[model samples]
Target: MIVITAPTGNIGRPLLSQLLESAPAAGEELRVIVRDPARLPDTARGRVEVITGSHADAKVLDRAFEGADAVFWLVPPDASRPPHDGYSGFTRPAVQAFAAHGVGHVVGVSALGRGTPVADRAGLVTASLAMDDLIASSGVAYRALANPSFFENLLEEADSIRDKSVFTDVVDADRRAPLVAVADIAAVAAGLLLDRSWTGTDSVPVLGPQDLSPNDLARIMTEQLGRPIRYERQPLDELHTTLVGYGLDEEFVQGVVDMKRAKDQGLDAGVVRTPDTASPTTFEQWCAQILAPAVRS
Candidate 1:
């Protein structure tokens, strides 16, 4: 049996579809834990077993992980909680469930930056790495899909991009890093979860097709959208203030700030692309396909 968590999220949603669509042909049992049963696709409800509840709840995981062979795990972000607590705390219950239920292989959504100079200081990355460690220590065959910044993140600023032709971030406009499509990330996870021939723990960095600076993305958007879209770097203090104003925890806000600073310092540049990590979606392609439709809407 294969179980998936966060089945309604950006990566998890797609991963669920991928698994369900392929499972029939491959003969794998697909089960998912979701807080909202209605959020699941109509095609999937009939095909896979659905366990409704937050995965963080040990009771929920206990039921979902029972007799499961492989599981896809991702700790969804909660801004109100500090990074340490948000990432670690959420995974703790699931870890206990993994052990008690005898789940064998686990695939987790995590970030890249395990070996960079700023690895220790990058807040979200640091927490994600810690998550990987905790899962690996569980003695399950684990593969942390260590991902870079996602191109889909730009959609969060869809209104700003549509109205002002500009978007804001803490990372420098010139900083170059591989931006992945979440589709590729899910694809990797679905592949890993289906086959259980491998064992042991490892990090699989899913870098996108190419590296592009924020300015470079702007240039592409200008051509694709027929508007002069631009990128702006907000001051770290300003970002911190805005986040805190939203009632976010101070430590979590700082972690976000530090993660951005680490990027500006070339933390993401530390990744080396190989065929395994280099996914096929480019920023330009994403802008043309994904961002374009969102802007038009």
Candidate 2:
């Protein structure tokens, strides 16, 4: 049995489908941990067994991990809460449960620059690195998928795109950094679960086909939507206030600013390959295929 967490999320939903489709035989079971089973689509609900509960609940986790050969784990971000063990209050309990359950293999969703110079800048990234350490200490065969920022982040500005015709961020307009699709990340993760031949603690960084900045994103957005989309760089002071105003903790806001500075200084510039690992869909393809349609109506 293959168990997946955060099944209703961007990656988890598709990852579940891909696993069920690619499994060697028809009887291969795919299990997903969900807070509420009723929210799942009829197709997914019909295909997989739904274990109801949050990832942090020990009872839910134990039941989900039981009879499971591998698991995909991730902690949902909660900026409203105070910073606790590695960005989320749930990581410690989740990791502890994985150890207690003796899960054989795991593919964890983490961030890039996990072991790099500027890793400490982002509280979330710093915490993710720590989470990976805890998982490794469990003595399970593990792979932490170190992913760059998701292109889906742009969706956060759906309202801004509609009202102002611009994309906004604190980072420099020309500071290019890699962005990967959550789909690619999910595909790589599924591949790992199907074949747990990996050994020791390892990090699989997925840098997308190219590095892009706000300006580059704007150009692509404008072209795809046939509208004048532009880049708006928020002032650093205002950026901090904005994030905090949105209910994020002060330290989390500061950490985000620090990461932007790291991006400006080119600290996030690392190239990695996922050759034969998975087929990566490009940003343009994502825009043409996903974003454009969402924006059209």
C-alpha TM-score for every candidate: 0.98, 0.92
Off by over 4 Å in 2: 24-27, 84-88, 273-279
State residue 201's C-alpha deviation in candidate 2, in Å: 1.2
| Per-residue alpha-carbon lDDT of candidate 1 for residues 19-42, written as tens digits (9 for 90 to 100) | 888877888998999888999888
lDDT of 2 at 4: 91
lDDT of 2 by residue, 1-297 (tens): 888998888888778778877864635578999998887766685778889888888888888888888889988876655445434457666667777877888899987775567776655677777778878888888898988788888888877887789788878898888888888898898889888788788888887788888899999999888898999888878888888888877776776677666666655575454464324788899998878776665
Instruction: Supply candidate 1's per-residue lDDT for 165.
Output: 97
Clashing pairs for model 2 are none
Instruction: State the local distance difference test value for candidate 1.
Output: 0.90
Worst 10 residues of 1 by lDDT: 262-271
Our model 1 lands, by Cα RMSD against the true structure, at: 0.9
